[model samples]
Target: MLAVLAGCTGGSRDIGEGKPGSSGDAIQIFPRDGAEDVGPERRIEVSIPDGRLERVRVTRVEDARRQAVPGRISDDGLSWRPAGGAGRLALASKYSVEAVAVDAEGRRSARNTAFTTVVPDHRFIGYFKPENRSTVGTGMIVAFEFSRPIRDRAAVQKAIRVTADPAVEVVGHWFGRDRLDFRPAAYWKPGTEVTVEVGLRDVEGAPGVFGSQRRTVGFTVGRSQVSLVDAAGHTMQVRRDGELISTVPISAGAPKTPTYNGKMVVSEMHEVTRMDGRTVGFGGEYDIKDVPHAIRLTESGTFLHGNYWAPADTFGSLNTSHGCIGLRDVKGGGGSAPGGWFFDRTLIGDVVEVVNSPDRKVAPDNGLSGWNLSWQAWKAGSALR
Candidate 1:
């Protein structure tokens, strides 16, 4: 019977037999003992040809963290496999399976086995935005920037799920091969809770390059706040929940380098940050070490920041910036400065629409500006379509 149990390891040399006086052949574990380089697509299971399975326990250890792999035994006690999302084996991990079975004669038998999942030559991961458990503006879009270019866009997209509580339709749009952003048809209604599930583990993102991340992150949508910037008028209107809250003077991009015209989301905010012209492809035109209350509006370096060096009159009357929106502020920021006030009130996902600028509308893929695209156009970028 011990030899029979050893055979149940599928010819594996390393097999653990049942206790003395029990039928070792009564229990079986798949992937066998000593299995190595097992692919995730291969299912891990335990079974008995006859009698009944009493209990089954599976565990996976990766990166020094031990996690339970949930599973259930069949009603007939003939088989057991992982349940639901836990069925997918994590990459580069060690899995252990233990099972107990009772034979027709009422003799209890135990079996223990383990296997190591495949460690790919290359792995891919995604760095997502809006942070877990964070409260963000309604315009926040769940975006993922992958570490490596993805070849199987469909597989990668399918692995991710973005759902909301107040349940509006949300869809994902791929920006090239390395970025994927998800959003609803319109800005999320205030107070919506959003959850993102990234099940990229073991998913083939490229040839022989498997995804190594499996995580769930969530964020809540705060109140509605969208500011509209009129470059021609040199002013910005701040609105909260469709109510005009304030109208502030501003200086837009100069004619030679006009700001992008269209809806732009505030992707980042800084109380004070260095601005180097050379970093954004400008020829050393301006390098302010401490640009106060800087808000990033585009990936290509367009900011709505405080301009202390420019004449106080420059705001509200001049479009003097190379391509940034400027508001009046002092050297160290703070006080009731318009720049600081806006920065204080702004959330990461808030919208900042620009109008009347000669420059073309900001591309939908630039920053989190997908709101600029029509619903139909946005859906067209989805890989599932």
Candidate 2:
């Protein structure tokens, strides 16, 4: 028998590293070495020292049905991106991964098949707005936009849960695309408490993006008082729970100032904003453009915001102006202005219900206020389950 240094490796002798045909040890999967409970958000990665990756094949160790072909390869060939897919690796199923690397001179280096028990967590998916751990005015949504559009959103919707320490009722609505908003149907029951838990990990979203993680977020739904404005009565009634708390008799808009009708989710709030006519589909016919210090409420130019030029009657009586929920105020969303008082107290997720106006339901895409659609209708728009 020929004497070959059995499994012996020496420094700088470097006699056998790249000698492909000499039967030197093949590359092995390093980190994922028997990695168990792998993240459902599995991002496949494999590396080779001297060889370039030719192809990767994923297969079920047992079931033939469980398999997928990864997407196109990149130019450098060092990394691969899946074509919006997970290789359908079975959940909690034993699996194997095979990677092939080739050298520039067509020298082939093979690695021993790496084995690991692929387990799935209680797959959860959620997002954080303002970038999750964020700080913004009460007007910002601590929104967790899903990585994928959620299927079974209703069932998952109920899961997003809010828990007020005081045990106030928290309801969440599924917004189109991938957003679920939790509120008390009113404003969050103020001063109570709030906790949101979305256990969507592994939960199947649209088709490709799976709910691969879970998350929790809780914010204070401060102050329960909400002011409801009636264009007909010209009375803005503030209420806590169900009782009228305060009434602001103010002008709204002239008939032409008709406020939008529907459940408006305060998508955003600005203490001051630059309002330009061209911004809201205004043409030269109505040259009065670019109103500043405006408290923009809805996306379609409607605002429970501040307007300077409009008269005070629009606050408590017939509507006027080009369809904005006007309030008695000056420049800027301040100045002890009646509009500022209401606007100041408002948060982004707060509810602004406009009634007695002829305007149609605000379009869903205009902002995050998609709850206006009936459950049946909302589901119809989904491209996937």
Best by TM-score: 1
In terms of TM-score, how similar is model 1 to the real structure?
A: 0.69
Residue pairs whose backbone atoms clash in candidate 1: none
Clash count per candidate: 0, 29
Best by lDDT: 1
Off by over 4 Å in 1: 1-121
User: How well does candidate 2 match the true structure in TM-score terms?
Assistant: 0.51
Each prediction's TM-score versus the true structure: 0.69, 0.51
- Regions more than 4 Å wrong, model 2: 1-148, 151-161, 168-177, 183-188, 199-204, 211-214, 240-246, 249-257, 285-296, 312-314, 332-334, 361-385
| lDDT (Cα, 0-100) at 318 in candidate 1 | 74
For residue 276, what is the lDDT in candidate 1? 45
Model 1: per-residue Cα lDDT over 268-311, one tens digit each? 66665545444344433444434567777776667777766666
**Per-residue lDDT of candidate 2, residues 228-309 (tens digit):** 7776787778665568766776445445435666666564454433232332343222321122224444545455555555
